[model samples]
Target chain A: MERLGSGGREGARRIGEVLTWDPLVRLTHWSVALLVLLNGAVLEDEGQPHVWVGYAVLGLVAARFLWGLVGPARARFTSFPPSLSAARLHVDEVMHGRERRHESHNPLGALMAYNLWATLLAICATGLMMESVAFFGVEWVEEAHEALFAWLMISVGLHVSGVILESFLSGRNLVRAMVGSFHKRSGGGA
Target chain B: MKLAPFALALAFAASPVIAQEVAQGDKIGTEIGAIASALSERGYEVRKTEREDGKVEVYAVREGRRFEIYVDPETGAVTRVKEKH
Candidate 1:
């Protein structure tokens, strides 16, 4: 039999590279996303599971916040600096149909990530406030929370669109990279 | 028996006040314990818990009333919490 382990006609080196996400980070990210979505969408029935899911989401966010301080290189916030000028330039490029390939999130995408997290934190805060007598049944607090939800939904839509656009533009399967933690070997452009 | 109605009526008459007292006490104690435990488990040091008869009654104190939890013991679910005030 031909050698099967790292020795074949195609050679030992794989075409693509893998930089798998830390298991905890990936678990927290996906689980938090699911919980937040469920809490926003399906938990309007005022059920026990809904409350529990909210608690779970809160816990996940807290953990992820801590992890961001001491996680993998790619997972760290320092890896993606928040630059308004950079973001504006990227937006201008996108509008002009001249976007660049990014192995990680582009400047615009990073801004979206920032918006998503900020809005999510606001949602959690307003949600907790709504539980109190002072804020409960208060129209403004409720409205604020609802408005944040709408904004978050829009941001999420745009984020997904950006992903699809980038995938095609970069000629790489971004979704697959997110799931499998593999990226096409680029010359460090993104 | 003949005395059963009298006793029942007496109990019914007094039951409201007694139930109110018991419910208020239970709400305070349980709310405090539950909130304290929950917070402590999540690394918060609870200071106290209290109950008052108002639009909102039950509350838990951690540092400075960190959580004002309204609970329905029947279902064991926190109806709400006043994390702000």
Candidate 2:
């Protein structure tokens, strides 16, 4: 088995150089991350920037969903359809020391992707509803938005933990992958 | 860190007037209807009200501006008003 992080030694050995993350994938990922952090923690919610950031996050989610249909091989939703059996198998492999590193995303990662997108959509929808004339001052809508935000925070925690765990197990820096670069054993393991 | 407790205490401090405004035994001091009436008197169209953090968090609109007014349950005073951005 090729050692994970062997890609760090570019001169001594070149394994497989693949562009796993497309520009849009990397862009949307970081953009959403920054916007969420800004709105959720750094920025004041009463400021105009907070609303604009929410709108930007909504736009990014919409674009990402659309890209999942027409984007590159790795970006397409077909690349990692959510499957319980597949996730179970991945879990089993992890337990048995037979888990193979995925070229794009593992089963659990795909589930998290779908979950984050859906949760964000819910948060944005409620947020937008709260701003509408009819729904303005509606308690349930605000409560729902708040509840979804809490879920989003939980999802974020899971995502970070999953990334860290996968990186350790696969020996590949997943963070580097999301930023448009990753190392793989060329023509060796599919 | 020391200021945190002070701030928390300040936030929850109830004035003497507030204690006299509502009964001591009753939680959520003033009735929701009374809170709504008080908000309406101030030009707010009360949309919804919930008991939160020992206060009545009223969601209301006034002259088309939405506001989240946290009212003291006992005194029915608008402790804080957060307008939508």
> For chain B alone, what TM-score does every candidate structure achieve against the true structure?
0.36, 0.60
Residue pairs in collision within model 1: none
- Name the regions of candidate 1 deviating beyond 4 angstroms: A1-20, A93-103, A181-190, B1-85
In candidate 1, what are the lDDT values of residues A1-190, reduced to their tens digit?
A: 1212442121112224323345565678688778878988877623557666766877887786776677655666776667899899987887888877653467887788778778888887887776654454445776798899899889889988987987676666666545543434433211
lDDT of 2 by residue, B1-85 (tens): 9999998787678442232222223233267887777666556688988888898887787777777777776775667777775
The sequence of per-residue lDDT tens digits that candidate 1 reaches over residues B1-85 is 9999999999998764442211222333234466456445444344334444422334434443345456555444555655643
Point out the worst 10-residue segment of candidate 1 chain A by lDDT: A6-15
Q: On residues A1-190, what C-alpha lDDT tens digit does candidate 2 reach at each position? A: 2345543321122233332366688789999989898989998755677778899999999899898888776788998999999999998998888898675679999999999999998988997887876798776888899899999999999999999988788776677656643443465321
What are the TM-scores, per candidate, against the unseen true structure? 0.57, 0.68
Compared with the true structure, the alpha-carbon lDDT of candidate 2 equals 0.75
